[model samples]
Target: MPGPPTIFVARQPIFDRRAAVHGYELLFRGSAENRFTGGDVESASAINIEQSTAAFGLDALVGERLAFVNLSRGALLQEFYRMLPSERTVIELLESVHGDAEVLEACRELKRRGYRLALDDFTDAPHSQPLLAYADIVKVDLRQTPEALTPGFTSRLRGKRLSLVAEKVETPQEHRRAMAAGYDLFQGYYFCQPEMIETRDLAPSQLSQMRFLAEVSRSEVSFEQLEELFRRDVAMTLRLLRYLNSAAFGWRHEIRSVGHALMLMGVRPLRKWAMMMGFLRLAGDKPHELAITALTRARFAEQLGPPAGLEHHDSELFLTGILSTAEAMLGRSLRDVLTALAVPDMVRTALLDGGSRLGAVLRIVMAYERGDWPTVESVRTECAVDERALTDAYVSSLQWAETSAAA
Candidate 1:
């Protein structure tokens, strides 16, 4: 007999103008298939939500922020969203859902219950015009909404009741244009791109983080050296010990010193932990979501390392994933960041060219982050891992990132 279905869920952060995460658009897949191939999308969505919420509390995936969940016409009519807390859930009506009387009545009922409504893939078509009346948010796909139309289009939609959200925004320029066009909310991976400032020197704090990351990356760094490095920075030392002593580690006794923590964790684990801390430090003044994104990528790549045939190179895999966002975090080119850290050729190549098995793992992880399941499948096939493994790795990585952030 076959086992139960494998559910895949990944979140895309939605940001305000200040770049702070306002909520997440939870992308769900009922099976390993990249796209919903056959079954009723409504049933699949309802079942996936039931199972995901029961198995892993909604709090686990989104924390305290709102969860933007997509719903089909049937799911919306059936009131499936009622299963979730109305206050924290944003009922996103898929573009396929029509705005007829029944649909509008369903939306009105949802509004009466204090649930916000969002219209996804919004367009200027007459079919979508009626939705503007009830929708609290209108998500405009910038890719489909032509550049010349943005100013006038956004101006037309700008109103006191509804806020405009710029979707598929992928660069700093796109983000700026969206803001200039009066978009109140923004989506997409634009924040992940490094803002390159020509001829700017690295900040002193970032330079210090680089030195620590470089030291940990060295193959022969000793416990004493690491201890001394931690010792020099009292705040970092406390954070390291505090993290080790957290419930996630579950040490029988309280970890007292940097030396004790280093000895217990050994070189490999210590290196990974220090690298994570280093990344957090390097991510100064950036959105908290950026740090979580890097951490999730790190853990996801690390979890997939063995399956991707890099079992012995987990440290390098973790580094490859975490540093993938270094350019964005530190405002330097990826090449410069890698060169400064003097990472191994394997890690450098993986981050730069996406070459080698390490690169395959990083590719899969990055694609999964964007809900690009087709690319995930292509790379997963290349790596010879099954869909369940990737999905499981992603779920666990999400949990691990949440824990690590709190720690």
Candidate 2:
């Protein structure tokens, strides 16, 4: 039996300060090896739907989280309902699924099992009309649908008592238009902006020293352990303080102790700078494409769910992503760095295996850098970080780097 080839889904919550997120629409993302096309359910059926649903169960659907997943006609015919607990998962009968009696009956039977149903990008269908009563939410894709006819279509569907969600609201203006049109839920980039920016290298040796500094920042090593790291690393310690105390950070007093400095700078912030340094550390001092993913993933992970694992006292996720491609950075296998720094097991799992969930997320970041839209998804189910927060991080990194240069 073949296993599910790792289809990660990241949800975008539709909420505001005025209202809590009532629901999240499940979006599918593929791995580095696979690209999930927006359409083509036939191609999707070639993978194991049962195992794929299990991965989704692991990544999402734990709590009261409600997600919308597109169901191909093939999945329904195969009795895929056994794979997911109907109570936790909602089946969005796809628009592409031809509205035959058997297909509609399958949807109706699934709904009878207490599953929430959605009509995917579909508002009206004579054959699927029976399934409409089962729909709890209606997704209105403002991006693809004609703007002029939206009001009329939305009005026609208003009486269904289903919540109208404006999917793919890409700008503030788009959000405003949707909200004004009485959209109960919203998704997209109105509140956040992605920077059209690029990163440059400072120098190679300086980068290595910064990584050494990052090791110090997130390290849980005792004072003696830290001092031991400093034995042959004196110059790195001095440069770290210089960068930390510079005018941009605006340290009013000269911070003298490493521990005190660590407390003030914070591990995430330090790791971010160290990532920039890591990119510059070798390969003739040119900004490489691979470094871009590491930086983006580190920046994105810092904004996500709680940081619990601190292998060797560092934020585990940051190292998981920042040092994911360590072999390339140092011109050796990750095994070399792992052996040298005494990194923890979890970090090892993420860097070398690419099998752990964190490893999966790291791959998403790489896909994102390469503009592989299908691969950059959240298999974590709930998203603590979305496009908005990431866009903000990118813009902020630029401003912070500029300030660092000035100081």
Of the candidates shown, which would achieve the greatest lDDT relative to the real structure?
1
TM-score for every candidate vs. truth?
0.45, 0.40
Off by over 4 Å in 2: 1-7, 16-19, 33-35, 38-53, 59-64, 123-131, 147-151, 191-407
Candidate 1 lDDT, tens digit per residue, 253-286?
8676788887876665544444334553455444
Write candidate 2's Cα lDDT for 276-347 as tens digits: 343433422333344454444554544342331222332666666667656665677777677766566766
- Clash number by candidate, in order: 0, 6
**Candidate 2 clashing pairs, residues 3+ apart or interchain:** 9-378, 218-313, 218-314, 219-313, 220-312, 220-313
> How many residue-pair clashes does candidate 2 contain?
6
Q: Highest TM-score, which number?
A: 1
